[model samples]
Target: MRQVIPLGTVTMTYPGPVREQPLAIELHNTLYAADGEPLDGLADERGLRAWLGAVRGRLPAQARGADPRRLADVRRLRDAVREVLHAATEQRPPRPSAVRAVNDASRRCPSSPQLGAARGGGMRAAIDHHGADATDIALGAFAVDAIDLVTGARRGALGRCGAPGCVLMFLRDHPRRAWCSPACGNRARQARHYRRTHP
Candidate 1:
């Protein structure tokens, strides 16, 4: 049976859009499962372009001018990010190649922050890309975010969705957040209930 969750006025399926997570986690979640089959959110050049536009706010690089030819680069970076995150969550060593890939991407195009006094007493900042284009800067920013997420303060909060057949990774933003979303939580509860009654 398919799991359907009705939250107040709207009804949602078992797997829903996994959002509000960090950029790197979102990248890792590009490969997710639906109805027993894996779906790549970045399966094509057009899809990649759309995904980049969706996350433009969080990325240092602008999305509108991204080259369609950079789709392969994004896919490779996402794969490497997923590999490292899997290893981190499992408390094992990641593949050396994965580590190298992330590092290389992080250094692909470096940016420097320029800070100055704001209107009052605070400070304002802007990024200086040093002539690099949008695509390279975006890739480097994504890799840098992955590095910080896996090795920084919130590293302990990295986790995978526990709902059955779900392969999305999420950062533990809430203390009691076990699944990636409310839909997943409801599905898990429904599964447990089914097992208790059917067995």
Candidate 2:
């Protein structure tokens, strides 16, 4: 059941951000699909600030207060994290550029980097980051989590939503869980029902 809302000239095609998972997954979900086209939840400064506020508990004070204007850098990190995780899920190598982005952001702080086997079998960075620059520290924190998630035990738990036209990631913490959310589960079921009836 889709409902249209009156929003003058512009309208949203996708559902709002579903952020009940790990920080890295949350970041990857910031860019979701809408009406078959990719949409970015953090497309603007306000969106970035709002997302930062939503995840404040997981971030440092400095990161929480990061200037929203640095969204470009934030998006770069998101892209890197997204690519790295997707590559992990496929058991393939992520591009060198993505690895560099994760590493460069991690180096924003002083830390002892731990080497972990990346999903594709290459050693990658796993950092216990220390705080530094106002906003960069937040980037560091996010990068650190992405590293840990893709290389840590939870790596096996990472999953992409199975619903059609949905581009969200989640941790399949429970054996029975597959969709990103209950709504997506319903969507998948509805599609299945429609296909069975129509065919």
Q: Candidates' TM-scores?
A: 0.86, 0.80
Q: Give one digit per residue, the lDDT tens place, for model 2 in 144-168.
A: 8889988999999999899999999
Q: How accurate is candidate 1 locally (lDDT)?
A: 0.79
What is the RMSD of candidate 1? 6.4
Top candidate when judged by lDDT against the true structure: 2
Clashes of each: 0, 0
lDDT (Cα, 0-100) at 91 in candidate 2: 88
Off by over 4 Å in 1: 1-18, 61-64
Off by over 4 Å in 2: 1-15, 35-37, 111-131
C-alpha RMSD between model 2 and the true structure:
9.6
Candidate 1 clashes between residue pairs 3 or more apart in a chain or in different chains = none
Which lDDT value does model 2 have at 194?
100
